[model samples]
Target: VLTRDEAQTRAQLLDVRRYTIDLDLTTGDETFDSRTVIRFTVRADQDVTDTFVELKPAELRSVTLDGQPLDPETLDENRLPLKNLTAGDHELRVDAAMRYSHTGEGMHRFTDPTDGETYVYTQLFMDDVQRVFAAFDQPDLKAVFELSVKAPDGWTVLANGITEHTDGVWKAAPTPLISTYLVAVAAGPWHSVRTEHRGLPFGIHCRRSLAPYLDADADEILDVTRACYDRYHEKFEEPYPFDSYDQAFVPEFNAGAMENPGLVTFRDEFVYRSAVTDTERQTRAMVIAHEMAHMWFGDLVTLKWWDDIWLNESFAEYMGYQTLTEATRFTDTWTDFGVVRKGWGYDADQRPSTHPVAPEAVNDTASALLNFDGISYAKGASALRQLVAWLGEKDFLAGINTHFTRHRFGNATLADFIDSLAAATERDVHAWADAWLRTTGVDTLTPRVTGDNGTYTLTVERTGSRPHRIAVGLYDPDLTDEGRLTLRERLDLDIPQTDGRPIGKRPALLLLNDSDLTYAKVRFDPESFRAVRNGLSGLPEPLTRAVVWNALRDAVRDGELPPHTYLDTARAH
Candidate 1:
């Protein structure tokens, strides 16, 4: 396994020109023969003479560099040592047999039980792309790839770019400069449905066994896809940076989906094998929105290293939930998020294994992989939502557009992102980064109220180092009927005792983070808590009720409130 330091050194030493892999999937019985040709120009700042390429081939047939034959026996477990290479343009070729993977790591092969057919897809996340072809496998060492594959006569082929199928051979269009992990290929007898939306080709695919299910829900899926596409265009300045979009629902997929540029591979269960609830369908819709968001955040403006993996997933998650709410009929999406997604973050943060949403350092690949837990996806998106609320939408969109304009089709660090945000806002983004991103634990917000002669003052006490910008909701009892209360107002203010935010007249109940605008654990004051215990159902707004419920849930997990009391509140409400 290559360490982060070694990858950084290799990235500094070489700039890859292009990668051309010729794979024959028809031969070798169960394994495929891959012949890779790489052209690169090496940088010579010092007297470094040795480097290596990565591959996990079944049998190493030949190794030739710069047209000179190198011994195949010198190939180590997954690396081929290239020796005594000078400083100019160089080409390396390797011919080997690579085994297909059953695990969802490299090239996964699956055989259907009923139809007696086989399918193959690649899930080359982390560093497993080496199992398919030889390359300098790292995010920063990006290069254009042109791949050609020989498959069975009746199978369809998909890749990161459009594929040209002729005479049982599939040649993919040359992709733009992209990371090696983003390269994708899936070949099978696919049942596909194609449509054109706004001058772009869109397609959905499934195996023959699941053809009926896909066709049944094709309209719903395509409508959500088209709606999210239009919504993303409205939010982002950069256009979608691909020729077409094809989403394949593959069997036994590991993740929800891989946002592999033009071709996204999703777990086939999303096609709905059995009857599912509306919530399950909403989840499917959200996953679609999430992966579409990645077309801009992860695929377009990529992170430089694995430590900032949250920058890719967190933004996609936030955009997914919010966009689904705005564009589709899933208007209660955030409520679902507060109930399901945020619970993952809250539980993970309280656990001993919790990490910061954006860790300060990840020393190795192993450490970087561990950081992709709940903190990365759920908590990090929660923080970004808070940032949007605090900074306002106009400024945040401007910052994102600036980031896209500056670092499109390139790699960027966390500092580079902050710099782009700083260029668009008056608030101190660097300070916010230090407080919100650099810290490891979650913040706790408690409201304190004081009343003197019919005037009330409410102050929010912050328990962690991070600062919070939240909305406080004041709700008074209905004067006409005893059913629900009237919302006085939602005051947007900073927490930890700020000025100009006066709690003028007291209401029946007070709510913190009124629409779940922040990412902090909240608790009510003594009087407010008592009011909540009695009149929890009187909260008219569902969002406000969700925030309150989540606060009680957090209180129970943190041991500040008893479990029975929390359940009793729920039962009473």
Candidate 2:
């Protein structure tokens, strides 16, 4: 990624001491200006004759290093050159202005029609961080950020860390070392509910127009936050790394939510201004938990490059559902994952855009942005969940704790995380990582049944190249029921076996990849397929039913089954 390369270069160029960013928020123009002072300790032995700052063309109104004016011609969209610098501590200050981007980049400005309130939010997705400020807009060039914004008198300003209002200007607490893409700010007339939990400030915010809707489900929203926070504390050695946790339901946010440290920005639709299904509410809760996990996994301990972004997102995605299931009232969260999230992974993995969960050699930001798809989030999470199932929860947690402690306030590659896991267990996690994270494409698990005398055998045949840790379920007809199939036993197995497991009694049905914990399409045995078509709802576990539903969903997407057939199957169930 361009951000990764620029970050690596900047890391070599300067030892960034701190960043002091000042913004005039009330600049009513579509464009705003910024002044940044980047102070760095120079190498005493080397004459820093040529130093560079990363900035775009239209952005730099003027440039100077320590008040000496520099030529605009020296500016490259990716870098600004500075000459005649002595080897000592020095300051590189930039005075720049940039227009807001309408296409989900840079500082995005818009006005809310309902309340007539003007709002400004920044969405610097991938490489857009440079559109807002002059810095090394890369993942590894972590910098301590001090932000000050002058906003309209009645509007509030939020950023990556906690902000204190002073003299009509909002000043953010200097952030711990963080990547620029994670730096954020939102300024507008906002409605907010503020509280504290376990000594940490917790708040939910939305535009003034959505205040009524936000108030309706305020309790549930905050309860989800409290539950996930408590759960993460129980799981990790480090507490929440940032100050004050704020979830803002902003308007027309590009993604579900941008995990911007203390200030997370969500699409206002999460406020539920209109009636929505209980399933929708569950989804909102999951998103909250997902973004919260990022506070630790993505924000606290960062990926060394865009290539290792799975270390940030996939881990958060898995922990989100797992924590919600263990700690919150959402006990059947994995069912939703199967029906919705896994479907996303399955669909994307089958598409032309599919990439490995942990992709190797992502050369620039454009390619990296393309990879923020289903495989990275959903399938990657499922793979991790299966890893937890195989390695056991305690060891997985130990490995994760070690990974976070070792990489806190720093950057880590995917290898670093796997090595930590390898330290926690003698298991071949490196091989697991290679098979699951490095390889592209999904595997197909087909259930083959054989019988000998009174015994039945069920064999799992993996059709794809990737290996899988999976669960096979044997179901038998309930003695008192006509159609219901009860789970007889669950067999945990690694896939691609040539032999089969013998059951003393023939099962009414056999299902492959029963839990949907692996990124694979499952082919049910003939009897199981018939059972799924006729009596899927009779399955005891909602998660099992979800898996069956997902298979049908996948069939529809793959054109193997007619869409109407899927609908008929759903209706029959």
The candidate scoring highest on TM-score is: 1
For model 2, how many clashes? Answer: 5
State the lDDT of candidate 1 residue by residue for 1-573, as single tens digits: 678788888888898989998988898457998999999988867364779999998999998998899999988788899887778789999999999988798888888997977888888887888999999988888889999999998899998888898899999999888888898999889999999999998999999999999999999999999999999999999999988899999998988899999999999999997889999999999999999998888888888889899999999999999999999999989989888888888888888898877887787777888887788999999999988987889999999999999988888888999999999999998999888888777788887788777688887778888767888899887888675777899988786655435678887788889999888888888778887887778888787788888888888877899999988888878
- Tell me the lDDT of candidate 1: 0.88
Full-model lDDT for every candidate: 0.88, 0.82
The candidate that achieves the highest lDDT relative to the unseen native structure: 1
Global lDDT for candidate 2?
0.82
lDDT by residue for model 2 (1-573), tens: 364555565566666668899888776567787888888755666655566667763557777777788877778656787776777777878888777766667787878888688778888656777778887667777889999998888999988877889788999999999888888999888889999999988989988988988999999999999999998999999989998899988877788988989998898888897889888888889999999999988888888778888767888899888888898778899988887788788778877878888888888778777788888888889889889977888999999999889999998898899999999998999988888888877777788788868787777777778767778778888889877889999988777775787766777777777877677887777777777887788888888887777777766776877888788887877
lDDT for residue 477 in candidate 2, whole number 0-100: 84
Distance from true position, residue 148, model 2, in Å?
Answer: 0.9
Clashing pairs in 1: none
Q: Residue 28 lDDT in model 1?
A: 47
- Give the Cα RMSD of candidate 2: 2.3
